[model samples]
Target: MIMYTAGDVRVEERPDPKIIEPTDAIIRLTATCICGSDLWPYRGVEPADHTAMGHEYVGVVEAVGDDVRNVKVGDFVVGSFVISDNTCEICRSGYQSGCVHREFVAGTIGTQAEKARIPHADGTLVPTPGQPDEDLIPSLLAASDVLGTGWYGAVAAEAGPGRTVAVVGDGAVGLMAVLAAKQLGAERIIAMSRHPDRQELARFYGATDIVEERGDAGVARVKELTDGLGAHSVVEAVGTQESTMQAINSTRPGGRLGFVGVNYDVTIPGIDLFFAGIHVEGGPAPVRRFLPELIQLIWDRKIDPGRVFDLALPLDEAAQGYKVMDERRATKVLLTL
Candidate 1:
């Protein structure tokens, strides 16, 4: 077993975790991610100290409890970054990510560790067709966090055919929002980007336009493109006051705004929002709501979300992974156990 302690995470052999209840399962992690939200806790923005740090992972079920009916030992599984048993009232309502008995797997289950003890296994884990090819693991892991968040953002934005969508921010989730809009049949996608590399990737992911400028200049460009009506939908992928304002201002009256950035120093202006007449919606993206469909999309190779991960590091180099993302040297970092 590995430990995520204060200061830094380390690997050491310990007693293997066992099924503490019939609903529990043991997952031998194959791949995991260093999430952008994890940064809040790691950077002391959240009161996290010596907490198990990680929320996204893909793995094989090493063992299963007797009562666990959906998954079995030896099956390949991809679980949401947040764990929830699918049978709860909320799960049945398609909000398993917020199930009444939901138990997040990040800190307690600790996906960053080599192995994880998952509770509410049936509701939390979704099985794939078979052991995925090595190249597919990263994409599967994306299903656990960024991909789901992006998909949720798009859905919330009301992305669809004939809709013009503007995506604020260029993080992995933002880039995936571009992909999600395209997949959902949006007629045009404007990716607000300043970095050439991210801009190129945005285009490759199906962004029909690129706004190199930001703030008011970016909003002006969006208006110019939309005949002064602004886009019909706006995706806010960076949780900041500036990006939030940019998203709100970029949408036309009656348009929808989907925001998924983990809010940091973000305060919505009541007057601006009310007068914009844009329908704003979003939160801690209910990823589990979209996991089944996204998992199938990956399985069929209809889309590849793994491309957002630009760097891979051993789990031991987790701190470096954080530094790389903080320094903007990598679009995203994948941690291998």
Candidate 2:
């Protein structure tokens, strides 16, 4: 799929990508999806003009360059949205998204096509145990981005036993975070959403509480639930300034606030943040770090993150997928090849 301009996307023919480096690999995509992050460009918050779209994907390896060792051609694989040389020092420390040679795979290298060239194959791509069942494909594709991202968000917030975890957005990422919090053993999981469908999904994912307010009302409701002590961990899935502050205010002193939403216009007040006394950690998720376990969870039928994709369309209707997501008609859109 190519974005001809802001709010305009269409499937345009392009040359099949080829390996550009010895570490590169070419894969024929089986499935891909539109992300909330993609809306940043679609909504024109960021520039877009004849730009390639999409990053989340799952596929079979068609070819690999000489230096690639971990995965061979014909392997079923899933990769992080951010390309990374997982061998780098930063990656070695479990932050592959911050690798010295990191490159975002979205705008620059769109995987929403039939095939794509993946750099740092051994580091960025993780092949499945085997050819997944047809029904498992969507879950596997999700592990490439949203699932891994939400898992990272929960981990960053330190959602664990005896803790009360609150999620700040009702989008796919936020829902994933709720699932992660449950798997991580949080004592109480709070999902803040005004949408009924999302609220129902949140309950399915183990949300014990739901706050239908926003801004100060949302913060007050959280505090009320926590006995005036806010939640132990708060995951901020929305990137606006209001949501950022809402997440921060919803955390108790010395608590954790994990922000996975792509911050576009968030600017915190230095004085308030200083006195907030909370631990904050967030950014482009190091999805490669969590892909292995996430894939296993889906493979084992322990989690069904694929339920987040409510709309499915062929690659030819990529425009409709973008339209539905931009209008919030679909929580997430799956593009079938």
Candidate 3:
């Protein structure tokens, strides 16, 4: 997929990716998908500039560089959206997304094509237990980004036993956050949304409450459910200023807020943040850090993140995929190769 300009993406033939670094490996992607983040550039919120698209992928290693040893040709693997050495001090501290050598996989190495070249393969890719079944591909592919992102949001918010986790978005990431909060043992998961379909899915993902309201009304509903103290943990998967503030106001003092949304214009006054006195953690999720555990859960059939893809189109139809998402017609679109 190539975006010639904002809202003008098309599937165009591009040069095939080959190893340019000894630490690189080329993989024949079996599955790839359009992400919520992809919409930023597509919607003109971010630059497109004839950019190559897609970052989430799952595939078989087609070839490997001499320096690569962790995975070999024929290995079915999943990699992170961000490339990381996975050995630097930051990565060792569990923040691979912030590694000294970090590189985003989006525009530089578009995985929406039949194949892609991956750098830092040793640290970025994790092979599955074995060859995955056809039905498992989507779920496995999801571990590359959305599922891992949601899991990070949950973990950052400290969603666990006796905690009330309120997710302030009903997109794929938000729905996945609801699932993550459940897996993390959050006692009450509150999914904030007005969409009936999303609300239903949230329930299936273990949400005990739903806030159909927005802004102040939404915060009041959450507070009502939490006895006016606000939720113990709040996940902000929507990156707008309104959504961010809603998440902040919905959190109790001394509670935690995990923000995984990718909006750039969101700003908060220092006084408000200082007075809120809430613990805040968020940013691009370190998906590589949780790939192992997420893969296991999917392999064991403990969670079905694949259901998040309500729309599927061949790689050629990515333009339509972007349209549907931009128009709110689909929560997610899985681009099949």
Candidate 4:
């Protein structure tokens, strides 16, 4: 949004993003989305004014600069929320999310519009097998953000066979986290959701347990399901003080806590963590690192993350999509160009 407000997003015509560097490439957005994280910016929690909005996108490349090589014109691609060049040291280390020259492209590259200019095109965008079928677009788009974030949470939390995982929050990210944990082979997944709709989807996505409580009560319920030892891994998808604490407390001693929530004022109690001996890790999930494999899964129709999107709108109705998500009337909203 060019202009920002506390409860609303305003869309206006502005300069279209173009290749500004040799590493840049421009793609015509075929599908883009309003991410849960976008709520933070829309609520005036992030620097809003004069910033472009959106990051997740599925599109066909329109042009590439001199240095761009990994992608080509007419190639259908899915871009990561964060931009990076793939050849960097960090990218090779499986941490493209933390690339040395990583740039937050949401409000700048702005996938929300009809066209987006991607910096470090080689690293930031992954080409799909072919022009995705109509039904595959949404699932592929989800991989660019929510699905990727959730998958990263599962990976970070060490969700796998014989392990019990607890996820805090029931938003799109949280619900997707449940799916990710299940796909990662977690024996049991405890999804913390008070919303009946979300809880239902959690089960569809492979949640073995559903806890309707929050805060300490939720943690207690999680422990109850895990033989009073707490979950082997905890995924924190909500970037709030309460959710963060729940994730931390729900993990057993020496367990891992994978948090993808964008922390604001949420503080981790040093003393409590010191005593718990929990291994806490995660920030902005390096979704790009996992895009190739995730894309393959979607292309094969092996997993359907499109289920998380409860609302869909055309690009012109972008404002309404934001309203649906901000008011919690919808879990995730998909915007079509």
Candidate 5:
């Protein structure tokens, strides 16, 4: 898929991608999805002049460069949106997304097509235990981005036993954070969402409570649920001034806040953060660091993150996929080849 301009996307027959670097690999995509972040371009929040679209993908390796060793042709693989050499000091430090050699795999080359070229193949792509069944494809694709991001949010918030974790968004990432908090053994999980469908999914993902309110009222409800101390940890998955304040204010002093939302016009007040006394941390998730464990959980049927894809369409209808997601008509849209 290609975006000629804002609010415009098209499926075109482009020249097949080739291995440009010694560490490159070519993949035949089986599935890809429209991300909440993609909306930034779709809604004209960012400029897109003949740019390729999409980042989340799951596919079969068609070819690999001579330097590639970890995976070979015919291997089913998943990769993070950020390409890393995995040998840099940053990658060794468990922050592959910040590797000394890193590239965002969207604008230069996109995955929302029949084929895509991946640089740093050995370090970026993780081959699955085997070719997953059709039913597992969406879940595997989720692991490529959203699931890993959500897991990172929970971990960054320090969710664990005896802690009360609160999630401040109902998108795919927030719902998955609820799952992560549950898996991490949080004593209680509170999901803030007014949408009934998402609230039900949050409960299924182990949320112990739901706050239908927003702004100050929502923060008050969170405090009430946590005995006025606020939550021990808060995951901010919606990037807006309102959501950011809601997450920070809903946390107890000294509590940790993990913000994974892609900020648009949101800004953090220095004074409020200093006075709140909350530890804040978040950025582009180092998904490569969590891919192995997350892939295993999906393979073992321990989690079903694919439920986030409420709409699935063929790759040809890429425009419609973007449309539904932009309108909030679908939690997520999956494009099948």
Candidate 6:
């Protein structure tokens, strides 16, 4: 799939990818998904400039460079959106997304096609325990991005036993954060959403409460649930000025806030954060750090993260996948090859 401009995506035959670096690998994609970040360009919030689209993918390794040791041809693999050498100081420090030798997969070549070339293959790709069942493909594919991102959000927010965790936004990431919070043993999980379908999914993901309000009213509801002390942790999954403030104000003083939303026109007020006395930590999630554990959970059928993909289409209808997601008609769209 290629994006010539906002709202204009096409399925065209692109040249087959080849191993360009000693650490590179070529993958034949079995599954890919349209991410929330992809909407930035789809809605014209960011420039497309005829760029290739898609980052989340699960596929079979077709070939690997001589230097690649961890993965080889015919291995069913999942990789992070950001390629990392996994030996750089930043990557070793658990920030692979910001590694010294990092390159975003979408910027180089798209996965929403028959094939894609992955750089730093050994460090970036994780092989599954074995070939996954047909039904498990969607869940495993989700581990490539959204599920890992939400897990990072919950961890960064310090959601755990005895903590009251509140999540802002009910998108795929937010819903996944609810699952993470539940898995982490959060005492109370409050999901703020007005959409019935998402609210149901949040509840299924272990959200104990729901706040149908937004902005200040939503913040008030969260405080009320927390006995006026606010929540112990807050996950901000919608990147907007209002959502950011909602997450900040909904947390207790000295609490932590994890923001994983793909920020658009967002600006954080220095004074408000200082007075709030909260610790905020977030960026593109270092998905590589969590891939192993997440893969195991999916393989064992402990979590069904694929529930986020409400729409599935063949690769040829890539444009429709973008359309439904942009219009909020689908929680997430899965493209099958």
The lDDT per prediction is 0.86, 0.95, 0.94, 0.89, 0.94, 0.93
Q: Which 10 consecutive positions of candidate 5 have the poorest summed lDDT?
A: 100-109
Error of 1 at 206 (Å): 0.6
Per-candidate alpha-carbon RMSD to the true structure: 1.9, 0.6, 0.7, 1.2, 0.8, 0.7
Q: Which residue pairs in model 1 clash with each other?
A: 86-123
lDDT by residue for model 5 over 1-337, one digit each (tens)? 9999999999999999999998999999999999999889888999999999988889999999999999999999999999999998999999999998899987877999899999999989999999898899999999999999999999999999999999999999999999999999999999999999999999999999999999999999999998899999999999999999999999999999999999889988999999999999898989999999999999999999999899999999999989989899999999999
Best of the candidates, lDDT: 2
C-alpha lDDT of candidate 3 relative to the true structure = 0.94
Q: What is the lDDT of residue 263 in candidate 2?
A: 94
- lDDT measured at residue 189 in model 1 versus the true structure, 0 to 100: 97
lDDT of 4 at 204: 96
The digit string of per-residue lDDT tens for model 3 on 1-337 reads 8889999998987777889999999999999999999999887888989898999999999999989989999999999999999999999999999999999999888887899999999999999989998999999999999999999999999999999999999999999999999999999999999999999999999999889999889999999999999999999999999999999999999999999999689899888888889999999999999999999999999999999999999998889999999999999999998
Compose the digit string of candidate 4's lDDT tens values, residues 103-222. 987776677888888888998999998998999999999999899999999999999999999999888888888989988999999999998888899999999889999999999999
lDDT for position 324 in model 6:
90
lDDT of 6: 0.93
State TM-scores per candidate.
0.95, 0.99, 0.99, 0.97, 0.99, 0.99
* Position 305, candidate 1: lDDT: 94
Q: Could you give the candidate ranking by lDDT, starting with the highest?
A: 2, 5, 3, 6, 4, 1
Candidate that beats the other on lDDT, 2 or 6, i.e. the better one: 2
lDDT of model number 1: 0.86
Better of 4 and 5 by TM-score: 5
Sequence-dependent TM-score of model 1: 0.95
Off by over 4 Å in 6: none
Clashes of 2: 0
